[model samples]
Target: MLERSTKIESPGVLKAGNPNKSLASWQGRKTEIAQIQQWLTDKNTFLIGIEGIGGTGKSMLATKIYDEIADFPKRFWADVSNGAGFSDLARQVLSEFGFPVPEQETQLVEALVGCLRSGQFLLIIDNLESLLQPDRQWGSLFYGDFFQAWVEDGGNSKVIVTTRERPELKGFEWLTLKGLQVDEGVALLTVLGIRGDLTQFVELVDGHPLLLRLVADLLKEEYSQDPDLSRLADLGLGNLRQLLTDSQVVGIHHRKNVGMVLVLDASFNRLNELQKALLLNISVYRGAVDSAAAVAMLPGSSAPEIEEELRNLVKRSLLVDKLNGKRRFDFQPLILAYVRYQAGDQSEAHQKAIDYYRSIAKQPPWKTKDDVKEYLEIFDHFYQLQDYNSAFDSIRICNDFLTLRGYYVDKVELYGQLVSKWEEIGARENRNYQAALIFLGNAYDSLGQYQRAIEFYQQSLEISREIGDRNGEGKSLNNLGNAYNSLGQYQRAIEFFQQSLEISREIGDRNGEGASLGNLGNAYNSLGQYQRAIEFHQQSLEIKRDIGDRNGEGASLGNLGNAYNSLGQYQRAIEFLQQSLEIFKEIGDRNGEGASLISLGNAYNSLGQYQRAIEFLQQSLEISKEIGDRNGEGASLGNLGNAYNSLGQYQRAIEF
Candidate 1:
């Protein structure tokens, strides 16, 4: 029932840094690899940061690059954990880099700096965040005596840091990662032997590589046992990755997800005050927050403080720009979740931010443009509330708001709503679509979208003609003729109007025929064929008289009088004009009566009955004023002016 998709693929693969170090199996990231290699070779580059969403294969890329460099006599791996102290990181780096570690802390530092005198080497630091944990006494190694000595002396090491988040490194480079391409993603899944169709692939993996691998491993296991069984039954059946510190095989995606979380928790425990606060705020959201909005939400924080904080976060590889216009700061899901957990202890600020947006959604629109937006916010709120009826109504109001602004989308959406409503009432397969056909046609006409209107009108005519509903067929044809008339195709308009008139006359629908005749007269009038216009107007007037349609008779009589007046038959015009006025008066149509009275006054003046003309014109002008017909009143004033011009009383005529 849905239409085809219209999304484009990214040009490269994203790095989803994992907890337990995994083997490299990557695709679509050669460009990124080449860029990193070039930067590392350049003298100006100090650190290369690896960043991406969870399951984006960040760790895999790092290990692949590390494996390619076989000549490095020593390669080191450090696990970032909550309990990881400065001493632990120093121990891993010192032991793996061929540096001698002594039992005494001071002896270890001297030997580590002595080992640093060695030549060019690659330092692969994994989970760099664990270095800043509160328990890790980051100051002891970062700024403290032992680590301070190494930092001052080490000048030949190329450090590459990989974290689920960017860590707060004082001197390092950063690279934010993206996800894998569709084909690369498929290739990754295929390597695991869960070969499946598009529908199945999307249903199972949803482009999350770890979940894809996990889901595939489960299905593969199930398929190996019972090849004939369905694949969906194997979902949520296995754990693929565990903590770097723990060795456990599980049977759920959430457990693997949580395992990654624990790794992040361990890393965050090591940060100093400024770094900790930056990471905490950066992980505070799922959607990007405007740089200003984020700073505003930060209590007691100044603009310069927020900008500097965010810049440090970016430099550390914990936060990056989303490239989306509305938001400036973005975080990985896992990092955000961990930060949120930390902030959960102080829930007031977070809850207030949510309330601010909700309040914006509830504000009343003060302009037509804002009116549409106001309802849209209400619509989203109701959708979040799971109140479909309220959502539907608010959206409907948005449609109307768009309509008043000449927007086409809201009009199309409105028609869709009406169709849905009809279906809800069991009218989808309508046997009597006379009402729907006319309404849809008229709606299309209002938009000047004539094709749909013509199609609907044709279908309506066919159905009404088949059911012997002449009135409906005539009405549809008249509307079709109006559409042609609007396009300046007078001949086609005449053709459609004639058909409608013939049907109405055949069905004894006098009022319908009269209306059709009035349309035909207008078409003829537009053609400048005065004789044909008079003929049709006469026929319409006769029917209105026979059917006792006083309003219709008054209109037809007035039109006929205009026709005669245009022909210079002044007396005949007066007769018909007076006749039109009597009907207009009988029906209490002040506008119609005023117009008729103005015509009578003009005719009387033409007959040289000045006093009578003035009396009738004054009466018409008063009625015109009462009925808000300025044109009619103006015509009466002009007639009175003409009467006084003839009598040399122009001032009195203007006053009258």
Candidate 2:
């Protein structure tokens, strides 16, 4: 399987705001509690804003803090999830604080203002994001003159506003909530008595308190039917995501009753049609989107208008900044699920995204550093839609461009899915099915799973032979040889390579012929047959040159260098490696460039040119790191260490 650069955590949590709460039962949020208490007791702070995504424990934290202040006699709490006007809010506030509810809107505002100014009071405004409406006649409760007057008055009063979105108004002390610690999240699940080892899933929820609680409750019900917990074990993080909003499972349990859709709908219902369109369109992309890509996705909307809407969505906590301060955004998983379903049949929008990305995939000379991320993103999106055509196309490009770019884990998963999709779509004898199997084989081979690689390659070979696809059969045979070579079965590898070479010649596929020739050379080299390896590499090089395949030519030259290095012909190895390195650089194939540098380093090391070996190895390491090739980085580091060891710099080698 391919490895990911970073393991992405699921949606984040909002911590408890008061220390007095039972950590044993509710789980620990000691630090957040301490901070909120400090702000509450401080004379300088008037308004405190608690902001986080839905199910992140915003309301829980606010309520905990509200309960903590036992002596603050004039206290009130209001739920604004149902849209309420300023007059209605003021009436509720005054009535809750033991003041008479005035009949007129003007009288209610006067009474609420008078009550706040008269004494120290605590006003907890729940769901402040829902109250933000540009068209509402009484939308100014938080943004207008009255709220400003309360802050300016600086009386013995503190107002806590719990919202998913951060209010635009200034002078408020903000406490942005984060996910809970692993231990706290585990404790929460333990308290719920969910019959499963949920430690792996703790990070999946990003320690969101409500999500943890709800998932625990759901798992409890599931485990009641089957106590083994193995039923839930097969469920991945995506399935865990479904559990959060699964109405059958979630039901009306505490904060779970509030529901993900209800929280999102508050902000969603307020968005203009264009903004809604933009959100729905972008939700199809499970990966990050930069401003330019987002703009391109919105065809008819003006650039400025789209930009403003994106900003608004960010402010409303609908779209989160993926690259902080980079104007790149991605939706929270729950929010994305909501938008994907609620945005009303976005097949056209999905088709638009597919077309745009597929066009990018078709463009040649894909710059590795710039285009790989986009290709991977598109690959993921296409796979999610079960669009096999686009998925295979995008992933094929990604296999070439991003195979060494530290996306092997993602590729393994994608290719495995593609294999299943081909089977599901009844593409048993289709060329794409063989290709998917080959891709899966390559992924497993990269991960050093030679047996798994062989299994896939064998499957591919069977399908190719069944369909009489001579070209695919050749490719499958060559790859089978590679998997065997990796497993140290050099004789077996050579047999497969010879078979592949014969098939390629029969089919007149010069590309396949050169590939099988190069692979045969590699198998021979592994078996220590230097002369035979050189002969095969020379033949492959000739075919590559005749066919004008510069990339293949470079690979053959590198293979020859490797063979020479094995034979202790250090100078000869360096000569071929230098040519290969130049060709790789000229072609902007960083993976190839890095491999050639490693070869040159090994050649120098074999010649006892330790200093020169160090130089080449260091260059390889730099290129590997720059190109995000972790396996290459590891190889370069090992080579560098070996060079340093030869020079008697043991400590320096250890550092490397």
Total backbone collisions for each predicted model? 18, 4
> All candidates' lDDT scores?
0.58, 0.70
lDDT of 2 by residue, 1-656 (tens): 00001111110011111212232357787888898888878988888898876667776787687876565776777655433335446655675667765433334545777888777888887766654543322233323555666677766778888776665566888898866888888877777665566676676456767556544444443345643334543333334445555656542332242334443444466568888889988876545576666766787777788878887676555775544445567664456656767866666666777666666554544433245545655665666566777778866765765466433434556677678888887888766777778887886786667898899999998988888888888888998998999999999989999999999998799999999999999888888899999999999999999999999999999999999888888899899999999999999888899999999998988899889988999999998778667668878988899899999999998977
lDDT of 1 by residue, 347-408 (tens): 44444344444455443222233334435434434433434455456555544334333333
RMSD of each: 26.9, 21.8
- In terms of lDDT, the poorest run of 10 residues in model 2 is 1-10
Find the candidate with the highest TM-score and give its number: 2
TM-score of 1: 0.33
Give each model a TM-score. Answer: 0.33, 0.56
Could you tell me how far off, in angstroms, the CA of residue 492 lies in candidate 1 after the best superposition?
A: 0.9
Model 1 regions more than 4 Å off? 1-416, 419-433, 443-455, 465-468, 565-578, 588-656
Question: Whose lDDT is greatest here?
Answer: 2
Candidate 1: what lDDT? 0.58
